[model samples]
Target chain A: MERKTLDLWVGLFVVAGLAAVLVLAMKVGNLSTFNMSESYELKADFGNIGGLKARAPVKSAGVVVGRVTNISFDNASYRARVTMVVDKRYQFPKDTFAKILTAGLLGEQYIGLDPGGDEVNLKSGDNIAKTEPAMVLESLISKFMFDKAADGDAKK
Target chain B: MLERAITGIRGTGHRVVNGVWRLGYASRFFLAVLLHSSMSFRRFHLTIKEIYFSGVLSLIIILVSGLFVGMVLGLQGYETLQKYGSESALGTLVALSLVRELGPVLAALLFASRAGSAITAEIGLMKATEQISAMEMMAVDPIARVVAPRFWAGVISMPLLAAMFSATGVFGGYLIGVVLIGVDEGQFWSQMQAAVDFRQDVMNGVIKSCVFGVAITAIALFEGYDAPPTAEGVSHATTRTVVTSALAVLALDFILTAFMFRGL
Candidate 1:
């Protein structure tokens, strides 16, 4: 009986572990969104996504107000379409310009909205038409390093 | 004696080359055998049942070990990350490490030390008691009957075991981080949540665990099958299974690291 109970407990532990992981995976996989009802989306067209990926934050000024949802190509326009969700409380004006900005020196890039006080509140699925693509620092550093490395002379 | 020595050296060299040649064939054969054994739907169900028995039965030991391990890792990770003033990276480090490499490898090692030895001893005893011979006389392919079930069981159990390890390890790390390392519980969990994604590191852990399981089962099965028919033989095989499985797990880890991290 003791051994049988131990075995049952073991089964429970394994199942619990698996269930926990599956929940986490589902959460990350976006198969299940949590108790979040405050989701407002905005789209932008960029020449390139740059260092942006899905789940990168959508910030207004320096504060994170939302997150990038999905990126797809507008096949006809040859522009990259980015969809993002903004929080309910953070109101945005009509004339806001969204730009993809680098977070830190080496950190991942995110979309930043500069709200213009045009006295009009934006709604869900609005478009931030004015946008700037990301400028990758690594490319600049590579150009600086490799240009010097290949030049044989170490002089600046 | 000299000629025999020369022949032995030549034979060893030939064996190495032959082994290299046979590596692909061996894998193909193993796959074929696996498929052949499970051709019947009944065998497939039996396989799952056996795998559950062999694999899930070891969860308690794995969890207990994983918890302590998580605590130790948290302590170590906190101490090190604090030096660089990036103590917030502790959650990411622990999560990534647990998901990518530590979880699977550690569980495999633990399983090896526990189950590997028992398996080797049990199989050795079966051989010693002529039970295997009796089965053989009844025309059962012992490899397919016994070894294959265990091999499949180990293979199946590994990912589940790894999941247990990672979860407990994370919980353990959480305890150490909040109670001892002086990090806020929210911050630790949030950092872990932000850093760990399914694609980046977690999947890699499962894949590594699966491969490790296959190698461990193969080595254990091989060692067990080849054990001598004596009490001393059982002991030797048990020791060999533990040592060899441990070494093989570590070696496979390096191989995986090289392949996965080479470009990244």
Candidate 2:
């Protein structure tokens, strides 16, 4: 084969290969959407995280605004301290409520930020005070059974 | 009967010793290739020619196999996931499988059969024809001139080929799930993007391909160089290249997956 033709073919192959990687990263994977912009950190404590993991999406009104950066046990407070990085573009008030919410009947848990009526906007390193823990299925079922038993007693 | 049993034990011992000796020799050859790799870069066209031969020529098989694999995953995943009424996860299943496991492993297996055997055969033939001896006599370093370019080309081509395979497979899944079946197109793509993290899944796969590339090319080159200068020897070496490369790819994949995906 001619040297020029070989060079051209090799060039095309390299280009195509790179383009494929680009497509995998941008379209097929979350490289285009996740953590691309600058972000601020906020901490919240939950009584029980219940399978919540780092890098889980933090959403506001069903739109992802950040990602969970770290999850650690607070020995002193006896709670799970979850730190999250929210995109600088989105800000919440000081009294925002953070809840560990599941997507479906069986799905990954995420932190849902419900903005509250407060004059002060949250800044980096700020801790949101109002937070709700993930609802454990066992606990919910036991509570329902207990309530039913009490109702039966009252009727008797 | 006692004599025959002793002979069997002796034979096994000799074979084990010979295998270890060959492994040591291969390691040295690997080092030599790395040490002499500057020539492949300095004379860039040589490597480019090899890239054309190995990478461009192998495109057809890679693409067709990738598409078929992806389509199969889509069908199978949909069948299983729909049992739980979560058919929207078809995209995630296909993408994750392709990006994390099937793409790199399958591409390397195919590359071992297609380009690897060819490399071994070519080099073994050159040795059989006394071309390597002639080059050595003329003060030309055959390792630098011949082996390095092919090695670098394989290494460079492998990751790219794997990426192309994965991307093609994703497209194939999209064709089946959304275009053929009545899947929601938005859910298909969105689920994939949500699940397939670039750094964790895609980059680890790229790293795996690179490792496979090195292993396949090195084994091919070593087997060819070590083969007896005869037609039968060259043919045997070519066969060894395919079998050994396949085994190496699978073993390395298990090790790499354990390291990369253990936490996830």
Candidate 1 chain A: minimum summed lDDT over ten consecutive residues — where? A27-36
- For candidate 1, what is the TM-score? 0.68
lDDT by residue for model 2 (A48-80), tens: 999898878899999888888789999999999
Candidate 1 local lDDT, residue A40: 77
- Score candidate 1 by DockQ: 0.17
- Per-residue lDDT over B136-167 for candidate 2, one digit per residue giving the tens place of the 0 to 100 score: 99998999999999999999999999999999
lDDT per residue for candidate 1 within B153-218, as digits (tens), equals 678678888877887887788789888768877657655665565654567677888898888777
Model 2 regions more than 4 Å off: A119-126
Give the best candidate by lDDT. Answer: 2
Note the chain A TM-score of all models in turn.
Answer: 0.66, 0.94
Over 4 Å off, model 1: A1-14, A23-156, B1-29, B39-53, B228-240, B254-264
Which DockQ value does candidate 2 get? Answer: 0.80
Backbone clashes, candidate 1 = 0
Model 1 residue B220 CA deviation (Å) reads 1.6
